[model samples]
Target: MKKLTIAFLIITLFMPKQSNAQSNGAAGAIAVGAGLLAIGAGIAAMEDMKERAELTATQWVLANHPELNSFSLKTLDFNGKKTKDMSSTSVISFKIQEFSPTDNPTLDGKKQILLAFTSYGWISDQGIDFNKVNWYLIDSTEWLNMMVAYAKVASKEKNETVLKDVLNNGLVVNKGIKAKGKTEIPFFKLEGDMYLVTDYSSEMKLVYNEKTLGIFLKDTGNLVQMARAAVIDTHEFFFLTK
Candidate 1:
């Protein structure tokens, strides 16, 4: 009788121990699955945030201005050097002569203006060498056209703050200000020490101070006078200025 009682007690303890082991294993499996799901949710949230940021930036730019159509990015040599060709990431190329309000209007209008720009080359052992020609023509013609259009709108509203912001931000002045008049017209001395007129009409010849920036006006007439200036102080131009 004693032996049977001892055997029964041992059996009861052993059964419960096995059952508890199985329960713990099941709980661990569920916990691991929950952890993986949490990780996946976090990753999705990050991607969503990135997309929202990009969309917000785009909307802000479009809502503020109009009269710009089809911005693009292209690689070109601006410095007249025959270095290795490189790609520009966000070079904003707009259609000046082609842009019309009918086909593409501002965000305020029915149509939403597409604003795009390119980024330049990456930093590496070989530094960034974007062809200067690419920037020159666009800066002179297309970029200027957009600025002129924006200026017209700003001037119509008589918004000096907006007008100044547009000129200072849109117009790429490579040099610091050489001379500024109190009458709201700002003159810049380029990196090459060439003087440029920023607030003139588009029909005037684009002229610069030869001594500093060394920009030579090919044509001297009414049309060229109105051409806007993109004065930059490059690495080479800075040395020349000193």
Candidate 2:
């Protein structure tokens, strides 16, 4: 785990910077325009209904789960879309860290989970609302455990279907729906039991309801990769389950 963390940090440290330079040397102008455009677009596309719902959810999580108060919120653009055209779609991420009771004596009395929250959304064409597509909450310890469990299960069973089944059915829990606008938002709950057998320093899991939409691993991988690419030596990586 330490090696993986170090490797990720090293790669991030040397990653290319996001340049806005253009061929005509109007880079600064273009950048300023783009920034203003994004801000304007965001404001113009703002949907009070969605914002209220998101705020409600965020407030509920913060008030109910005080342990997650330290987590940060962030916004990002989607890079995997085929069209290079700019859109109102954006991603929001939250991250936190969890340590074992024995490892951190100070926090031993507190909850055992270090939770992170991240999500993705798009601004409507009308630019009056945001359409959220994906969201995730994870415990670092649980994530480490799950990875180890996956490796072990894969080595033993070598069956992708079975492995997927174990991950989707046995390890993950379907939370209820979150009403946002006209859409019924699906959510999930996860536990540490799924990854306890793995030799990981911690355990973590993310959940989403399949009745509304299927969560894809590839999307999760992309989010992780993007977060890793942006920050070096920082355990706070952004991600979403679907």
Best by TM-score: 2
Tell me the tens digit of each residue's lDDT in model 2 across 116-168. Answer: 22333333344323233344454544443443343342234444454443433
lDDT of each: 0.33, 0.34
Which tens-of-lDDT digit does each residue in 26-134 have in candidate 1? 7655655565555556556645543543454344445543544433212111122112213233222222222234555432312211222223442234533323112
lDDT of 2: 0.34
Candidate 1 local accuracy as lDDT? 0.33
CA shift at 115, candidate 2, in angstroms? 9.8
Best by lDDT: 2
Point out the worst 10-residue segment of candidate 2 by lDDT: 206-215
Candidate 1 stretches with Cα past 4 Å from truth are: 1-22, 65-68, 71-242
Q: What is the lDDT of residue 136 in candidate 2?
A: 42
Backbone clashes counted, model 1: 33
- The C-alpha stretches of model 2 lying farther than 4 A from their native spots are 1-57, 63-91, 97-122, 127-134, 149-242
